[model samples]
Target: MPSPLVVLSHLRWDFVYQRPQHVLSRLAATRPVFVVEEPVHADGSPRLEAIDAALGVTVLRPHTPVGEPGFSDAQLDVVAPLVRRWAVETEALGACDAWVYTPLATPLLDAVEPRAVVYDCMDELSAFDHAPAGLLDRERDLLGRADLVFTGGPSLYRAKKDRHSSVHCFPSSVDAAHFGQARPGAPALDEPADQRDLAHPRLGFFGVIDERLDRDVVAALAAAHPEWQVVMVGPVVKIDPAELPQAPNLHWLGGKTYDELPAYLAGWDVCLLPFARNRSTEFISPTKTLEYFAAERPVVSTPITDVADPYGDIVRLADTPAAFVGACEAALDAGDADRQRRTEAMRAVLARTSWDATAAAMGRLLDAASRAPSAHPPTPTHSSTPARATSTL
Candidate 1:
């Protein structure tokens, strides 16, 4: 009989902007999976019902209230105790055969006595803007405690390999069947009347508008090519819209739900990933890269390490603003036959890098950890210290 498996993550289900849901869905097929998430809002109501419906797994949200101001020492203090208690309670609920903790909840997992521990390092948290201080230290401590560490991309794996003996690269993968539906002639996003009135060939980008975006590059591209309308779709994070320099041709479409992404992808002549070269963006393995390919659209990206790897063939890589603009021009100039060939190549590549494959790799790591000797040694007992000579009234 197989041992029960449990997954711990700090990310809430409503914040399913990441690929945890897809990974959880794959893991659920083999064993009982439980996701321990943070509380969604200040009200204490969990936003995990949709995730429960989607993954068929138990979703546990602790009742602890997040601290005031959201991002202070006070908040961390409020949340940490609750998270620790939840971890302890979850451990007591059953004898978990193995445990996989995503990066955010790694500290909590450290206190639990699971049979095996696997650490999933999906992102370099410390490099992110507004990340908690001492994040890297915490991650290092978690890495030391983990039986195995799994990274989301080659770049991340390379960065982390020196810290852990057992580290593997598992890049972001797409739901091929879902994304493949975006072939030309499929239903596209309804272009806004204003957008429709202005343009013919539209270059688009769809994802979170965060610090990782090279705003200067985007502005330059839009300004340089008045004929091409550059449409951006995603909610802004860490930056105010007013602060960003905008071009007349640039349109911000806000964000769309995951299910509606294919429609937006289908309508674009090309997809762009203009990431600023920084610690956070350097190791990122954007899930949208393959999604764009699956939609049969040409792609242009900044020279991020991971994107420049296996995707160099299908994705045109650029270093500077001028180079990126030139790449976009090249992509636009390419005939439909060239575009289709590249898309086919991308499809073939993505089929091999599926969520099922990622889950299988994780399963293997967990299995090995379950069999391997414990990395953590037992604590030694200490004799009581002699009482000091103290005067008490």
Candidate 2:
């Protein structure tokens, strides 16, 4: 019989940004899946209704809110009880053969006594200012105990390989069929008034407007090409919109639902990812890169390692402001023949790298973990262990 799987993550189904749901939705075909998430939104009240509908997985969110920014005491208050409850619940769910913990909830792994533990390190949490102190230590403990580990990008995999015997790079992937359907005449979301009036060729980008974005590069490009309207869609995280060096040509249309993304991408002449060189941005395998290609839109991105690989053939890479502006112009000016060739190349790549494919890889890792010896090879329990830190995603 196939082993049952349980997924532990900070995010519940309703949270639109979580990538684990995408993978989980794909994995539901092979096994019974259960998700344990933050309790505050436990009654299926979170925006994950679509995900729940798609994945057919049981979700359990605790009634107590655990961690939050700027409140160490509150975080601990929530986590301690949450951990105890999780332990009790996992013990009750006797058929669970494996546990897959996303980074945020890995700390709770100590409570669950699963046959195999898999750590899905999808992002470098330590780099984010909001991440809790001693997070790195918890990650180190988790990695040390994890029977298998998976990273979200090549750079992340390289950075973590030495720490674990079994580490694999599984970058963000897309539901190609969903994105590829954004062809001409597809219905689009109600365009923001500011963006609605803007003249085409619409140069666009979608995703969080966070500290990783190179504002200088975006500003330079917007200013240099006043005729080309730049439309940025997504939530602003870790960065204030007022701090951005905005030009009249730049329009910031705040966060849209995931279902609306393809419609926006379909109308774009070129897609841009102008990220700064920072710890948070370094190992990121932006899911937008694949979505852009799936929509058949050409892409321009910063020289981030993960972004430069795989999609490099279809994307223009730029380091400096001038290079970025030049690349965008070049991408826009490329002949139909070149564009078609690049599009075909990207389609082939996307076919091989998809969320379904990624979930299969993860499934195999869990299968292996189930067969391997437990890492808990009888270490003496310490009353209090000093925090040890490690990287993630």
Candidate 3:
């Protein structure tokens, strides 16, 4: 039997089905996967709420009296004992692997004697708005303990490479068939009610609206094109929703499930990535870039380092609202030949990677670690190349 995978994550399993959910769900097909979410404040004593989230995955939501929900020291103090007890009761500690997504979760490592420890650094959390205190110190602790470290993008890999002995870049990947349902002439999907009434030439974006999003660009886009609708999906987080720029053409329909995203994408004429070039967005590799590509929609993005370096060839990069508007106009006015050329380019990009290939590569590393003599194995020679992942459409 495969080793049980115990995951400590800042993201909730049911929340946006991004990196952790995508990779773990694929990993769960072979291993028993248990995800311990950041704590939720409750009046009562600390406890665990286990929900069978998928075929081989169990999501453990910790309820603590502490106000903070992230993996802070206080939260670790409350969650460690609780999770240890749960692991003991469930007999999941034996021959298990601890997969960590946040540095603050390092304290929880004392709860288990796993075959190996994996730090899957998906984001530069310390730079995010309202990040907890002592995050950098905790990240140092996690990096020291982690047997292997996986960065979500090339930019992140560069930032973390020198800090850890073993670091690998696994950039965001796409689910072509899933998002391809949005392509023209594909099976008709039900239009979401919130977006159904919105007028066309829709320029859409889906993902958490936080400090990273350039609100001015969004407002400017809507203001410049009264005939065109700017539809922003996903939950508003960290930043105050009241602070968001308002306009007649702008509509925030809020978050939708992973299954419902394609329906919304199908109706969009152009996809957007209007990220602020701030500390919070320095290392981000927006997954929506590939998702939009899979939908065969023309994409316009701020020149985020990760997105620009690898995808500037295919995606339109615009920083100013006027340039953004111009790019969108170009996208909307493109002839069939241009669209087809972009579609073919996107397909070539999508063909290079997938979550399945990523998980498998990770599994190989885990297996190697399990077979090694020490919990932390000797570092393999560092390479600039990203993990070689191949997938079939």
RMSD per prediction, one decimal? 12.0, 7.6, 2.5
Task: Spell out the clash pairs found in candidate 3.
Answer: none
Give the winner by lDDT: 2 or 3.
3
Q: How many residue pairs of model 2 clash at the backbone?
A: 11
What tens-digit string does per-residue lDDT give for candidate 3 at 1-393? 668889989889888989888888888988899998999999899899999999889999999999966887777888999988987888655778889998888888788667788999889998887888888998999888888888888888889888877887877677788999999889999999999999888999999989999998998899888999999999998889999999888999898999999999999999999999999999998888889988989999999998888777778899888898899999999999988888888877777777788788887777677667285455643323322222232
Model 1, 276-356: lDDT tens digits are: 999779778888887787787889999887777666777889999999999999999998788877877776676456778
Computed on alpha carbons, the lDDT of every model, listed in order, comes to 0.69, 0.70, 0.86
Instruction: Give the top-scoring candidate (lDDT).
Output: 3
* Candidate 3 global lDDT: 0.86
How does each model score on TM-score?
Answer: 0.83, 0.83, 0.95
Instruction: Give the Å shift of residue 297 in candidate 1.
Output: 0.7
Ranking by lDDT: 3, 2, 1
Which sections of candidate 3 miss by over 4 Å? 373-393
Candidate 1 error regions (>4 Å):
1-6, 39-53, 63-93, 97-104, 110-112, 185-198, 371-393
Number of clashing pairs per prediction, in order: 0, 11, 0
Among all windows of 10 consecutive residues in model 2, the one with the lowest summed lDDT is 384-393
Name the candidate, 2 or 3, with the larger TM-score value: 3
Candidate that would win on TM-score: 3
